[model samples]
Every structure is written in structure tokens, then in C-alpha cells.
Target: MTAPGGNMPRREALPAEPNPHAQQLAEQLRALKDHGELSMRQLAARTGYSQKSWERYLGGSSLPPRAAVAALARIRGADPVRLLALHEVAAGTWNNSRTSTPAPAPSPSPAEAPESAASPESAASPESAASPESAESDVLVASGTSAAGAGIGPAAGRSLRIALGAGAVALVLAVSSTVLLALRLDAHEDGPAVASPVPAAVTTSAPAPVYTCRIQRVDGLWYAGISRTPDAEVAYGSTGPGVAEAQCLLRRAGISPGGIDGMFGPLTQRAVKALQKRSGLVPDGMVGPLTWKALRG
Candidate 1:
């Protein structure tokens, strides 16, 4: 089947750290679409969103907006409140993950800087050598004064240590966040789950009934006739041979009517509506003359 928009590029692959909440919501959306037996285009038509948008949402390539989620839930007869809650959670998580601060670059230590511009060779020149004793006395006095000034008070030293510890803690947190993001991505990649196909029939102890109808054309119109009239309207909740005939025609048109038990249920109605929409007729969930003709093809 063609994607909703013509010749659009495929969506990018899902990120490594896909938001778990978003993945859950996407899975639920897929399940609902499968239950409804809807194609992307059909879903788009019903939900007023593009088929491409639905594809991205269902594929987990992007988190759908709240309005889109609600629309899809309504179409699939699901609980909008629950789905929207999931959306909100996923949206918040995704946003937070995206907004994490980048780790700071490591700063150079004080020892890495140059101590002084003067070299030992320049200091040991003849003129300096002549006053070596005086120079040595001056150096001793400066060293003693420097040592006294460099001695930090106990309280100041303790505060400095506390500040350093806090910086270390902050650095650790930043590193941990990065690692966690990576692990989340890895987990998501490892557990790729595809949605299971929708069951053709609901579980029941009783065997399902089979239906058959004869197709014929008369007066340039086609019909799947099980009755003398051959043009009877079959709608939801309608039963008997005519319903069976409509179901048969629907099956022939490549649309499933849930099962051919001769009962017009929701599945049958949806099939009729889909066929009507495809044939450019009013999709009122009723199998009228135009729908019958289209299905008979």
C-alpha cells in the first residue's frame, strides 16, 4: 500500500533511548488500528490526519501530539483519557531526556601551568654568583613569609574541601545521566516488539457459521443476491441470508466482515463502510445499491 503522502522519505529509525512511555502508546495505537482492520489511509481519513503522520506515530519514530492521540483513540473505540495520560507522560519524559545538560569539559590542574619565566642558567650568571650569599638570605626570608601566608585556617580549609566535594558530586551526577541515557537506548533496541495480527474471529465455544451467495449482473448493475429481490439493503444488526450475502460480497472485495455467521455486527458494518468509501459512495455503514454493485465486482 502506498504511504499517505506521495513519495515521502521514510521516517528515521527510532532513537536508542526511545521514551518507554512513547513506545507503550505507539504499541497501543497499533493494536487499536489492527482491531479496527484499518489501513493507514483509511485511518487518516477517519481521524483527519495524514497517513504519513499515523505511520510515524505507530512506528515509534515520533511521539504523537495529544490531539492526535485522542483522535486515534476515538476512532478505535479506545479510552482517550488513558491514551492521553500515556501521551502526556511520554511527552514529558522525552522532553526531559532531550534537555539534559551536556557534561562539562575537564579543566587543567594548577600544576600544569609554568612556574616562572626565569631559567637556572640565567639566574646563575656571574653577576648573580657574586651576590650568592645575599641572594640565598633573601630567598630564605621570602620562603618563610610565603609559608606563613599560605597556611589556611582550619575553617577556611574545611569550607574549601566541602566546595570541592560538591563539585565532585555534580560531576558524578552528570556522568550518571549520560550513562543512563545510553542504557535506556540499549534496552529499547534489545527488546523490539512487533504488534500481533488481529484475530479473524472472537473466541467462542460454538463453531462459526459459513455463508455463501451467488453473484450476478442484471440491467448493467452487479449484485450478490441471496433473495428474490437481489437488491435488499443490509445494515448493522440485520440478519439472515441477505446479511450472509453482503458478508460474502465483502469478503470477495478483500474486506473481512469479521465472520460469515449471517449476523451483521460491527465488523460487517465497518467492511460495508470501507467498501462504500472506496467506491466513492456515502459511507453510512449500510450496504445499499451502490455498495452492492461495488462489492459484486
Candidate 2:
């Protein structure tokens, strides 16, 4: 059921991207934030942090404190392990941003370079240079010698090794990040967690607001026009607009999401699995980018 004239107030965009490393951490936090459907005020009230601080953390402007992350995990019923891992990795960038790097040793001046290089050659007597066949070069020259005996200089060799090492580390991080994200999503897709407890600060007397799934087209994608977050991970414990959006997409695909009450329960999980199985996805009950793309498509 498409709502042709569906409208939702546009939300303010987040600040410009933060450091590359920090951005990944921020994105995960944003997805969790969507899961709870909490406002900045609500998050601040719960975590005892200022709303501005949350804006910085969620916008990737700064690294969040460990305690703050833990508090949010508790509130959202997240496992906290993955979030903490991401935070630990992102902290490298945070710490580096504050620390100053030392400059490299200066290269010898051009005038001094020639003299310094020539002194070694000048030191060798002509008698040693006139070595006939007594030098060890006879074997090397016959079997493996080339005129290219001069290898990279010490400075150049060190730089090359450092660059290669950095590239390898970066590749490892990229792979690890992908696997961890998949594992986290897969881990969350189960029977809903037994919520431990809601802190008094963030607790409210009012009932959770129900969202209507106003399905519509935008940029050639189907959106609920409620949260308008296409990539947020929606799992068993998730709620709010993300849930409503999934429900609408499930229904659009001709599977009932048990009527879209904005809570993620057994029926919605089944609907998600049905869609994944039909679409040839892995059929993990959680809805991440791939599942969301299938839904929108």
C-alpha cells in the first residue's frame, strides 16, 4: 500500500563527516540511536551527557566516552562488545589527533652529500679495487651477478617497509570491520532480548509512540517516510520508525508484518526471513543494508 501523498517532516542533517576512522564508529551509534527512536534530549537525559555531546558523538565530531557508550548499550539492549571494540579502534584516531608527530631527520645538504658518499670510496685503496679473481665476486658474477648490486638505501628501505606495514594493517581493519558488522547484525537477529531495565532518568510515563508506515517513492527507493533511514539495522530488539519501515516493506512484498505496530516481534522477524529467503539473501532475521535494499527494491 503506497501512500502517494505521504509526508514526514524532514530531519536536520548531521554535521560534516569526522575523521575516517571515527566515522565508522559514529555510523554504528547512529544505527543504534535509530533503533531506540530516542531524541537527542532523551539520550542526554538517559546518559547524563549534554545533548551537544551526543550531537558530537553521533555526528562523528568526537569520540564518545566508554561509560556513555555502555549506558547507551544498556538502554538499547545491545551486547556492547562490538560497540566497545569499534570505540577502541576509533580511539587511536582520537588520541593521534591530539598528539604531535616529530619531524624526520633532515637529509644531508647537496654539497655535503657528495663528499660523504665519496669518502667511503676514496678510503678503499686501488689494490683492493684491482682484485682479479680472488674476490668473492667470481662465484656471484658467474652464477647470479648483475650490474644492479646497489639495493635501496637504508632510509628508502625503512620507508618502504613502513608503508607496506601500514597498508597491511589497513586491509586487516577493513576486513575485520566488515566481518564484525555482519556478526553483530546476525547476533541481534533472534528472539527479542529480555530488556534488563530502563534507567529512571530516561524512563517516560507516556507510551511508545506508534509510527504509521507511509510508503512512498524517493530517489527510486521505497521509504516509509517516517525515519527515512534506509541502512539502519533492524533486529529483534529494535523499535520505532525502522520497525515500521520494515513492516511496510514486508507488506509491500505481499507478506504481512503482522500489521505494523512499530515493535519488532516474532511476526516481523518471520516476515523478514521470508523476504530474505525469497530474495536469495542469507535469511538472517536481521535487516541490514542488503535486506533493506531488497525491501526497497
Candidate 3:
């Protein structure tokens, strides 16, 4: 809901029933402080107004000059329209105070001005027409603050109300932009992660079995060589399933089993022992029950 002084039309009832303008002015002050990231003291310092004065203005205990309103807008980097509207309110209140009398009959609505009147100044510096004092007054009239006061007359109040309504809409948009930006950042930071699918298990159980014939006698025992040819060896260096399984297990564990040249060679023997140790089995190179269970698993 709009405050009495603000442009917004949905006027909210405040506990400060005697002066609806006071509540809206308070909101304007809060919006400035929030948007500008300024403390009351800091705003006072920037505008050359004392902190006490700022407090009183913001606290709704007293009204300030149109110049002060413009100074506040400049300090906050806010649009001058708001400040100007506030200035008008202050001026209206001041003018009314001189008479110390009730408000006169309402006046007719003012004619619409060029769009340029609504646009921000093009120059880097504020124009003389848009000076702090002028702009502050403009803000007051624009926000319906002056309308609420006695001096501006009844017709001016309606125009000021409309203008303040428009200004309030602009303010809402400005504030929402910041809120939207924050929401976007929060979404990016806490967004969910897409997970990869786990691989399917191979259906085939029995591995293509390796053939095992006793090798030619080497010095005395079967020493993992050809049976009759003596020169010929197995398909690979492997002696039997036991050694091959050990090699396969080692490969699965990210260790090299020397190209699966599966002779029960030194490399194979070491790999078997390593697997045995990893599986909490006795560290013998032999594929006994414990070692076999580990390799199979």
C-alpha cells in the first residue's frame, strides 16, 4: 500500500493515524538506507545534515527541507523524482504552517508535462533546475506529500497522488531487481549436481577357461613350460586358472599383471601375494582356499 506522501495508490493504514504522510516518508528513508547501504550517520555525513536531523526526519517526528531531500537522493544514488516529491511534501507542510489554518478547497488536476520531465537528467552533474532544493520539492509534490498538506489545494493533491503512485512503482521495480539478482546467485551456488549412471554388471559368469597341461620337467618339478616339446609354452605364460585368476584380480585392482603373459613367473607370484594381503588372506603366492576366495570375489 502507498503511504500518504508516496506515489503508490494502495495506501496502507499506519499507527501514525494523525499523519499518514509520516509512515510513507519513513518507508522512503528506509528504502534509501537499504538501497544505498548507508547508516543514518553516514547519510548525514554525505548530505551535510546532522545525524540527529536525519534521525528526526526518518523517525517521522519532523519534516525536513526540500533541499535535504534532494541531498539525500544524491547521496543514495537514487532517482531525483523521489527526493523532489518529498520536497513538495515538506514545502506544503511549511506553507500550511505559516497560515496555521485548515486546508482550502481542492484545485483542478495539473496538465501533463513532457516525458522529459519524468526522465533523469542527461548531464553528469545535476542541472540547476534539478538542484537539491528544486528536486526535493518536486519529490514532495510528486509523492502526494504536498497534497496531504494544506497549502497545495485539493486538485494538486490528486495529481500528486498519481505521480507518487508512479514513483512508488519505479521504486518497487528497482528494489526487486536487487532481490532477483541475489536469488539467481543463490540458485547457481546451491544448484544440484548431475550424477553418472553406474555401469551394468557383465552377465557371463564362467570366464573362457584356460587350458592347463603339465609343463616339461625343469631341473625336477613341472616348471611351467611345454609338456613334450619342452621349447613350446602355454597360450600365454600362465600355468593354470589359479595364476590367471591372480593376474585378472591384479588388473582389476589397477596393478599391471605384465600383459597377462601368465607364466607363474616372479611378477605373477608377487601379484598373487599382493592380492592375498589386500583380501586379508595369508600372503603366500599359492592360490589356496583363502587366496582363491579372494580372487573369485
- Per-model lDDT: 0.64, 0.67, 0.53
lDDT (10s digit) by residue, model 2, range 202-278: 67567767777778988888887776776899899788878888898889889998977788999999999999999
* lDDT, candidate 3, 142-251, per-residue tens: 55554565576655565555455445545644685689799998877766432212222344446654533333334442332212222222222457554554555556
**Which residue pairs does candidate 1 place in steric collision?**
16-185
- Model 1 per-residue lDDT tens digits across residues 1-297: 244433222333444554888888887887787677777767766655555557777878766656567777877777888887888799678655544532222222555323211445334444333332224324434444443468844334333433443344346446856997999998787764422223423443467555566667667654566653456887888888878888877777788988777898999999988888889999999877667667665
What TM-score does prediction 2 earn?
A: 0.31
Alpha carbon lDDT of residue 15, candidate 3? 42
Task: Kindly give the stretch of ten consecutive residues in candidate 3 with the minimal lDDT sum.
Answer: 226-235
Candidate with top TM-score is 2
lDDT value, residue 56 of candidate 3: 59
Identify the superior model by lDDT, candidate 2 or candidate 3: 2
Candidate 2 stretches with Cα past 4 Å from truth are 1-204
Name the runs in model 3 displaced over 4 angstroms: 1-17, 93-297
